[model samples]
Target: MDKAKHFERSQDTAHDQACDPGRRALLTRAAAMSAASAMLGAGGWTALPAWAADTAKPAAAGEAAVRQGVWRDQKRLRDVPWRLRLPAGEKPVALVVFSHGLGGSLDGGTEWAQAWADAGIATLHLQHAGSDRAIWSGGLAAVKAAASAEQLIDRGHDVQFAVEQLLQLQKSGDAAWARVRPDALGMSGHSFGAQTTLAVAGRDFQMRSAPDLSESRFKAFAAFSPSAGHFPGGIKGITRPMLCLTGSLDGNPLGQERDGRYRRAVYDTLPAGAKALLWLEGADHMTFGGGGERGAGFGQRLLGRERDGAPEKLAAHHAAVIKTITTDWWRWRLLEDEGAIARLKAPKGLNADDEWLQG
Candidate 1:
């Protein structure tokens, strides 16, 4: 099937969902509150279950553990607009690029980037021109309709272009992204950004049976809220250590596929070793990406009404868990942190809020 045809059908399916009044009617006030209750635990501060593999007392402590003992600064590349998350003190051991989901910006990736910086690693939060939040200045409708096959292809080009510029800057002794270990590079993204990461990691769409756009420079990968069943031929050449994160509520609300399980296909299809998946019980799609209003509001759009999310305090806890997991994965994959390996491997120390699977 031609990718253009696939994209047209996808848009039609999504637009159909938007036009269905029956679906909108089902998302009443009662349903909104129920959905909120299902997502948010007691007092709206949804408490996390005791992690069997992680004995960390509170989510804040774990957040602190990942955020502590590291000095960092955020800088902007002159023309690129890429957010540079450079750890203070010594040179970084590795570099990681974080691409935000469709209609997302650099801020969406700040939490994870900070966690990586805290671990003494560098992170680049790439901002895309055509697909970022600028497209949503009107409202959610634009966001849903903003993505196109051309924009999708451009997203991948953006990643490759940013990597080249960064490497060239380092070579010129800019000292910002200097000392980044070429062997330990990492790539991560959320939602549409995950699609971008997949392209850079060697998932060949074979659009018209075209060539793949895998960037060998990326040695490790991570994704949040990635839609499955889109990439044909699966991940043909991706073999790097990978971490796929999602919540029980994560899925396509506008499309027919609403189950979170569908999102796991990437993890299921990746080559065996060094691959891991973290499923946060009761977590909605927005939780993994930590979208302030966008994350919370997308749920409302999904349900066809305006519904608030878990309490602010409770939501923050979930975001913290996401940060901890990403930082730990990067640690093990890029810097060879033994503690991260122990944490990732600890079968007995599981958090009640998080269900982990490894392959």
Candidate 2:
């Protein structure tokens, strides 16, 4: 099936759940909180205050709910924006730090973080100044002009810095942060951010020198629509379980091919027993974000482009599905939720789908 048709069918299958008024409300609320938290004050825009331990609540209807707010990354250059969501409870099973693609921000994939939050996991969406697409395009001309390897190195530091700050917050008994199991920490990102995740997870992307892994953290990693330009020499020496997700409709055909080649290279090189690749059919790079016609249209407008039709709708549907799968994957890997894993690994088996499993 063509991309448009495939997305339409996926939309039809997901329509009921995705359009639920409650779910939509939840997403809106999360978005609003994220925005509000960002604008509250210097601290609000920069970093999250200690979470109140007593503020935890249980998920309504057994669904994980997101807590929208900002977190301060002291290491962030110029205090970038951040969004965090956590399951309503005192005990968080695990923490996942989510990084956005080049030219994207915390808002790019807030819903994905919400899904993880709803699944009883805590998620942090960090917006890095040097690597964010907006910053790259509008503010940091020099960094934007840097070689792809340098860009990856810069982004990798952003991820590493964010993780370090979070760890510090956890160690400092911040009330806003529910103590997370350090060993269960996971990292995920899209495009450039994806490559950063790999670099931070003890993998050398050949973009720059390998980061010091002994001080490196994160038990698992997920990369969505990752760019492979930085992987000139391929990923090597990654022992952590990794998950790489992609879409059939990702633009920049060259980037997509490179992403796939490096992903396979890393997967093939990794020792057996702890890695997976999921390629969603009829989906594009934007699918991992807000995959609705409206959201896609808005994204295009932000990029100063004219609006299109089927592509927008298809993109939105892809976003919803990606959100679902992301939650499932993190739940399985970090929370040890076997049921979610089974669902994620199982095929929907409908037309226009692609998924591969390797060791």
Candidate 3:
């Protein structure tokens, strides 16, 4: 599918009138990103403040839930094409911004974004120009040239730019972007996108020439199939709530961990407690992208093949796993739903093949 057009169609859909100023203010304050000092507390359930603990509470059994809506527009963010998925009602909710992996389009993590939107959270899909699927424009040659210290920094700023743009919309009271709950924002990425997530979540690099990419706006992070950068400096323990998703076999031949421990490596560096890790059994690089022939052969050739014996058959089940984990997790972080945090602590609802481990 023409990735650019895919984003265009996303904005073409009908949008429901969103939250009023009063409701938007309430949701934003309730979900605002916590201070770094607050995050430093022991990194476990016990560290959560009374209000944070209160946010973790679940809804009554018989209560009706909110539905979600989607809006797409290629020009919404200028050069950065995007798709916004929001909750259906006029009440405000949490919002998450997702970055696509290398050689991936905005829809790469569609299933997860859909899951968030379905549960009354908003999701903004970001398509970074330099490192996105467009890198494969001329096949392998372009693909080989895709990764660099430069583009990675650009990817990180793209997210900041998106957030800044929304802040502007909030000021203008624009019908679409303005409705986002001001303080209830989270960030996530897949593969190369995971590297971007690391950059935004306070991970600095060796190059001084690059822009200061650590963004305070994104209060939490979720990285899928994250890769190590070539430059020198690295990540220390991140303080915010984080969920690292990786598979036993999810390694890139071009990455530092040839044995597929890259995901765990990133997970290891995050502060514990508000942090969790999901290591799906038999998952691979392509599984997170919904499984199929991907890349322009550059990725396939350089990395050979990063897949299991029955990757196609396992794709659907893995999709469900991502959906369940992300939906419940955002509920914990954004809504302050105590029950969602409990669900994440145990994660018994996922497939038996999955392992839910925490810091």
Cα lDDT of all candidates, in order? Answer: 0.60, 0.54, 0.60
In angstroms, give how far residue 341 of model 1 lies from its true place. 1.5
TM-score against truth, every candidate: 0.73, 0.67, 0.72
What is the C-alpha lDDT profile of model 2 across 1-359, one tens digit per residue? Answer: 33222211111100001112222333343455456546654452244455322233445865554444344443232354555566666775688887776566666566666667766778777766654544434433332332233344445655665666677667887655545777778988765566567667665422222234222567788876554332223354666778877655554321223123433344555557787776656555556543211222233345554433434666555555666776777778787888877886664542355666647
Q: How do the residues 1-359 of candidate 1 rate in per-residue lDDT, one tens digit apiece?
A: 55534333221111122211222222342354456556654342221122112222222422322111111111111122466666656454688888887667767666677677777778777767667768667566665655554455546666765676666656666445466677788998877777677667776554343333478888789987665454434563467777888766665645555446767777887778778888876665566665532532353465585322542335666767777778888888887889988987763334586688898
TM-score of 1: 0.73
How much does candidate 2 score in TM-score? 0.67
lDDT of 3 by residue, 76-191 (tens): 22266666666656567788888887677766677677677678888877787767777666665555455544455457656776776666656676455566887778888877
Off by over 4 Å in 3: 1-78, 206-208, 229-233, 253-259, 290-298, 301-306, 351-353
How much is 297 displaced in model 1, in angstroms? 3.6
Cα displacement (angstroms), candidate 1, residue 229, comes to: 2.5
